[model samples]
Target: MNSSMDLLQNYIQSFGYDWLSNVLLITTGSFFLWVIWRLIYGRLEALADRTQLAWDDLVIKAVKAPISMLIWVWPATVSVGLVLATHSNDDVVWLGKIDLILVISTFIWISLRLISNVEAHVLDQKKRDETTVQAIAKVARLFFVTIGILTIMQALGLSLSGLLTFGGVGGLIVGLAAKDLLSNFFGGMMIYFDRPFKVGDWIRSPDRSIEGTVERIGWRMTIIRTFDKRPLYVPNSVFSNIVVENPSRMLNRRIYEKIGLRYDDGDKIDAIVDEVKAMLEQHKDIDATQTLMVNFDAFGPSSLNFFVYTFTKTVNWARYHEVKQDVLLKIMAIIKKHGADIAYPTQTLKVDPIAMARDAEQPVGIVER
Candidate 1:
């Protein structure tokens, strides 16, 4: 091996082709790097596929491009450095700077890809909403990319303090001018973290009279589709200030009704209450976990009043209405079977016929009583 190395060195020196030797060296190094990357990455990929954790797959995927860049770009940079070595040591120094820039750029690329992959994995797992995931990933990419740019600038020997000062001054000015936009941006961030509501959720704010399904949550505004199918674009800042009710989070749909029984059939009020309570308790749609109240709550002027309060196990509007209808019909059946009737509003007035006749006679003759 020693003799072979000596012979090869002599051949290169004799031909004055030192650059060719460096090219050969770069090629050999790149080939080994490529082989190692393939072996390691292939095993990791197989292992990731076997695991239930999707993030490992994302990690493997995110690593691939950076390794590939190193395998390809690093050797090229080294070859460039070798070629420049003969020109001037100063030229080789500049090559090192270029290599530094390339390395930072590659790092930024990997960072962005990692963010995207991990966010996508989380979205697939539904740990957060698509809107929140996308927003967070965008922010992460911007942050890392900014860092990479600053790093490249530092490597290029630019003064960071001056640039930062100028940027700060400009940012202050822009921030003052676009305060509303900044508010909306921060409001969107709040939604991401606080998670008051999500896309496809039904939300209503009583104070704002805003009720709709969330269609999209954007950087500046949230798009809501009303029941009439109109799209309502609301600023993200509005959600921060308003009291939003998320009915989608409710475990059950409520049913509240007041039934009036006739005064004469009040004897069946206790039986009616018992029947209604039994009906609610045995109803297939009623949620047994919550409080069920059926009692004769009040006595109206014209009738006996009872209140039925319960919750349905389902929150679907159509199904809830169906369940409500069934319970109501059953209540009516129980009332009818118990020989009681639902009361209606009525009024009566007492009149004195004798006094009316006397007044009529006196008004016609006014002279004598």
Candidate 2:
């Protein structure tokens, strides 16, 4: 052992300390790193299996322990090996540079894994009611990527001040080029914070109207799947600018309808109004707190028109329709019971061609030749 050590020392000395120290250091560091990695990874895998938490499972899935080990161990081994073998000479400068790169890369990888874990955790929490979680996740990812890029630049020996100066100029140019993109990005943030609507909400805008369930909130747009199974992509900018009507948020939906009666049936208007109000009051879905008004709204050319205005407690289309149908059926029954009749527009006219020709031939009370 003593002779082996002496021979190793002599060989290392003759070969120039830089090369020999690097080799020895790298080999030793790699061996130890492998042992530690195997032990830690095995234990973590076991722990992950025993835990019932889904976020832990996500962590295991997001990060490949073997790949992480390789990335972390290799550069550290080479850096230490070169420093020990060459006594920190210029020949190992390349190894230092590689080491810096590796460190930056590892940090990025770990940060990504951490972000994934955070997203998983946030999704797991049921109390986070906003559907904008996906938008939030995207913003977080961008932030982490920016940090990673800055770290890599620093590792490359680039001064942060100069890099930041260039980045500011580049950002201005890029922002100008992607004005719509910036609008969308800020719009997404507004959507998340302002929370105009949420997933599963039915919304309508002035220009665009659709009854859909919000599918997902993305970084630039919000996706909605209509009842007909068509996907709608609405830009966040438009959402911020447009008037959004969220039907789902309404406590009740107002319904206004008109029914016409024969002009001769004007005497029955008061009775019809009373019957309609009774029918509305008996409706299961009608809001009792709302004023059910039946008023004589118009005198048409051939009919006496009355209007019924009420609110339905439920916003569901089918349920509202069902309630309206029941009310109409009740109204019809009441009208028939009272022997009253609805009216349709009609007209009568007379023509006298002979009399019109005689009148044209001579003025009234004047003699004609």
Report the number of the highest-TM-score candidate.
2
Looking at candidate 1, the ten consecutive residues that score lowest on lDDT are 1-10
- Give per-model CA RMSD: 7.7, 7.2
Residue 233 Cα positional deviation in candidate 1, in Å, after optimal superposition: 3.2
Model 1 spans > 4 angstroms off = 1-56, 65-99, 127-139, 215-218, 228-231, 282-291, 297-304, 316-318, 343-369
Can you give the TM-score per candidate against the true fold?
0.69, 0.72
What's model 1's overall lDDT? 0.84
Positional deviation of residue 327's Cα in model 2 after best superposition, in angstroms? 2.2
Clash pairs, candidate 2, are 17-85, 17-86, 18-86, 21-85, 22-81, 22-85, 26-81
The candidate that achieves the highest lDDT relative to the unseen native structure: 1
Residue range 299-344, candidate 2, lDDT tens digits: 8888889988999988888888888887778877877777888788
Give the range where candidate 2 is weakest over 10 consecutive residues by summed lDDT. Answer: 1-10
